[model samples]
Target: MVDDNKFKALVNKYVELSDQIAEVGAELVALRKKKDAMGELVMQVMQQGDIQVLELTEQGGKLIRRESKRTEALKKEHILDELMLLTGNDATRAQASLEKIHNKRTLVVKDALSRKR
Candidate 1:
């Protein structure tokens, strides 16, 4: 039956979406932990009685940048996961739905970052 086939397809997509959500959730948690650790380390360095000028080494700068980028990537992945879960009921519509979600998430992050200054 065509209806049965459609139902099966929907179920499969739902399962895949669930798995993606779990993966993204784990990634988000790890990203948060990493960001927190970096923040703590920076705080500890600042709290030291004698702040060494060498603390701001090139390597440290690179590490900070890399961590920032990782956080952004995790956020993007989370948005994608959410999009997939929401659109999983209809395979034909999923791609457009995901693109919209991606654009929205990008704008949201951009706006939030801009407000920090």
Candidate 2:
């Protein structure tokens, strides 16, 4: 009782949606780049003289600005060195154990012949 025409239409729609997702993702990256540039300018202005908050009045709200320290993560080589020092395990064993704990699964559907260089 499956309608072949309907199934074909659904497949085509799925491919179209995947294409739309790629387009939107690209747009989001572009927007984030612009936002980061603006944020850097704001940060430089804040650091030059201001020591505390600067509130900007808007139509119905305010923009608060402040600074705080962000934690810096150790690099891969440093982390592995520490792990080996603490656990007495070599790189290969540590990686295998981490892989077992970190593995997860997701289902992916790709358009036929869509991936290319």
Candidate 3:
């Protein structure tokens, strides 16, 4: 009868160890899945950041081009006004026309700059 009790106790101990091992295996699998998901999220965020940087660079280039064009237009307007005054056929009319053109160009340039900001 004592031998029987000892044998049963040994079997119970073996069963308990098996259960603990199974629980640890399940926990390891869960940890692996969470790690994989986190890796994927990091990759997605990096891709989005790259896209945003590219867009910002393109916008900067466009703004530079627009500013250059505006400068050229303003210079041309100034030169034409000076020439018109020197020629002296109808100074008042020429000045008025030049003023109108300059005003329109200035508004367009201001609008573009504002949009960029």
lDDT of 2 at 9: 91
Candidate 3: the clashing residue pairs are none
CA displacement after TM-score superposition, residue 50 of candidate 3 (Å): 9.9
Question: Whose TM-score is greatest here?
Answer: 2
The TM-score between candidate 2 and the true structure equals 0.55
On lDDT, the stronger of 2 and 3 is 2
Best of the two (2, 3) by TM-score: 2
Error of 1 at 82 (Å): 43
Task: Write model 3 residue lDDT over 11-84, tens digit each, in one string.
Answer: 77877777787799999999999998985675577565653222237546421111123333347557566858
Best candidate, lDDT: 2
After superposition on all CA atoms, what RMSD does each candidate show versus the true structure? Answer: 19.2, 5.4, 29.1
TM-score of candidate 1 to 2 decimals: 0.36
TM-score of each: 0.36, 0.55, 0.31
- Candidate achieving higher lDDT, 1 or 3: 1
How far is 111's C-alpha from truth in model 2 (Å)? 15
Residue 44 deviation, candidate 3, in Å? 5.4
What overall lDDT, based on C-alpha atoms, would model 2 receive against the true structure? 0.71
Per-residue CA lDDT of model 1 for 34-80, tens digit only, reads 99998778757755744433345765643222223334345655655
Candidate 1 overall lDDT versus native: 0.64
